[model samples]
Target: MGKSKEKRLCKQVKHDVLEEDLDGYKKLVVNPTHLCVKCGRVCNDPGLLCEPEPID
Candidate 1:
């Protein structure tokens, strides 16, 4: 089994996620019921924290 990376608390990592940067995340963008697949951090209170940069 592969080892999982440790997750940083949202408060610890500085993010600059924009509203436009969350289209693929769908409702999860605003309603994160799970941790970010990449960052392993829970979604922000508003639930828009995405680890992957948004696609154009």
Candidate 2:
């Protein structure tokens, strides 16, 4: 009687989803999509968004 040995191979798959980018990120940059909604949506200015509303 002849017996054969079985071999098993396993490998890991790595995906580079997140990358380290510091080309232009060396300086502080203001986010344009950021909203300071403190007052209301009528105000388009970011600085004016923090204005207090008038009392009734």
Return the clash pairs for model 1, or none.
none
For candidate 1, the TM-score is 0.26
Worst 10 residues of 1 by lDDT: 3-12
Clashes of each: 0, 0
lDDT of 2 at 39: 23
lDDT string, candidate 1, 1-56, tens digits = 33223423342355332343345224333544556557665543323444533322
RMSD of 1: 11.7
Query: What is the C-alpha local distance difference test score of candidate 2?
Result: 0.24
lDDT of 2 by residue, 1-56 (tens): 23212210000001121133233222212233223334232222233234333322
- How many angstroms is residue 2 displaced in model 2 relative to the true structure, after the best TM-score fit? 99
Task: Give the best candidate by lDDT.
Answer: 1
